[model samples]
Target: MDDELHRRLRIEQARALLDNADPRQAVMLACDLLMAGVNGDAVVALAAESARTLPAYDANRRLAAVIDELGLPELDLPTAVALIAADTCERILDCSIPAEVGTHRLYVVGYEGSPLDHLLPEVTALAAHLEDDLGGRADDDLRTRLGALARTILDRLKAENPA
Candidate 1:
């Protein structure tokens, strides 16, 4: 696909992931969008929206900082995903959220009464796919891999949800 078309697809995927309350998927989608060179504003908007929906997610803060550093109103998908991975790394090393219950807590925070609650399962499934795709990939290739994964996830989500 052309760069513009790719960016648009990334944005749409990001928005869908956010609406589905899948911050992880949204993060991946944001990475793809950034890799595609979508406007930073669009990226930031998706990050902001995800942040708004999941206030407890620290990844959102990192994404916001990246957006500011890039001097964009929002972050693109690639940048957003990178920020998320960084945040994940920090959390893993620091044990910030209490490893025993962090995943459970995140699930509760993400799906509790949210309009996108119904998508939580799909998001979890997608995250698993992303984890697999990200394994053994070089840093520079991360964005490309994420972009492809985002497209696959979006397609799967659409097929299941059909809207």
Candidate 2:
């Protein structure tokens, strides 16, 4: 599909999900946009719009949390996290599944990989940084597990796009 068409579809899908109070769906929709070569700023803007329209909805909150966790200066943290976690797991699942499926829907706008895929490293790094910031030390086994996971992800990325 064309970029404009894909973006419109994503926005429409996102709107429907947000209207249903599905924050996870909103996040996934944002991710799909990112994967489709939508600008990060645009994706963030769409997410912000969803949050604004669904102020009382939990999905709005969760999406805000993810945005905050991404360190976007425009987003608030605690409030977003609270909103996201308010819903039960089942509701979260409903929001998440579509987003997960939509991940594969990419467009050849520029880069060869999904922006979300690249953010995995940033997520892991942030987790480690937070662990250190909180003075919460992981056991050796946990550290090993995390390291292994990092290496696995890196290896996969490297294999997929050799330098």
Task: State the displacement of the C-alpha of residue 48, model 1, in Å, after optimal TM-score superposition.
Answer: 18
User: Clashes per prediction?
Assistant: 9, 2
Lowest-lDDT window of 10 residues in candidate 2?
101-110
User: For candidate 2, what is the TM-score?
Assistant: 0.23
Model 1: how far residue 85 lies from native, Å = 1.2
Per-residue alpha-carbon lDDT of candidate 2 for residues 8-127, written as tens digits (9 for 90 to 100):
343333333333334445655666656656545645655555534544355545555444544544413322221222222122234442321211121111122332244445444535
Could you give the C-alpha RMSD of every candidate to the true structure, in order shown? 13.5, 16.2
TM per prediction? 0.24, 0.23
Global lDDT scores for all candidate models: 0.42, 0.40
Off by over 4 Å in 2: 1-18, 45-163
What C-alpha lDDT, on a 0 to 100 scale, does residue 48 get in candidate 1? Answer: 50
Q: Model 1 Cα displacement at 84 (Å)?
A: 1.0
